[model samples]
Target: MFYRHDNWRVGLNFKNLFDKKYYESQGDWIRSGAPFTVLGTVSVEF
Candidate 1:
């Protein structure tokens, strides 16, 4: 979800809500998994 104003904005987000196992492969290395994550942000533009 997101919101915007004349000079300000706010937003919220969630990643891996279910805490599912997510894997990332880099070269020959593999990441196990990532847990659920939540994020929020605020911004202002002049």
Candidate 2:
């Protein structure tokens, strides 16, 4: 969560929130996961 004034900025983020299903390995080559993500951000500065 994030918020700011003056410069104008707002942000919120959430990733992998209870998606639960993982498997990642580089040794034997195994990857399966990452399926639930939500993010938002806005910024302006001049």
- What C-alpha lDDT do the candidate models reach, one value each? 0.89, 0.88
- Summarize candidate 1's per-residue lDDT along 1-46 as a digit string, tens digits: 9999899999999888888887989999999776888899999998
TM-score of each: 0.80, 0.35
Best by lDDT: 1
Q: What RMSD does each model have against the real structure?
A: 1.2, 5.8
Q: Which ten residues in a row have the lowest lDDT in candidate 1?
A: 30-39
Considering only N, C-alpha and C atoms within 3 Å, which residue pairs clash in candidate 2? none
Prediction-by-prediction clash tally: 0, 0
What TM-score would candidate 1 get against the native?
0.80
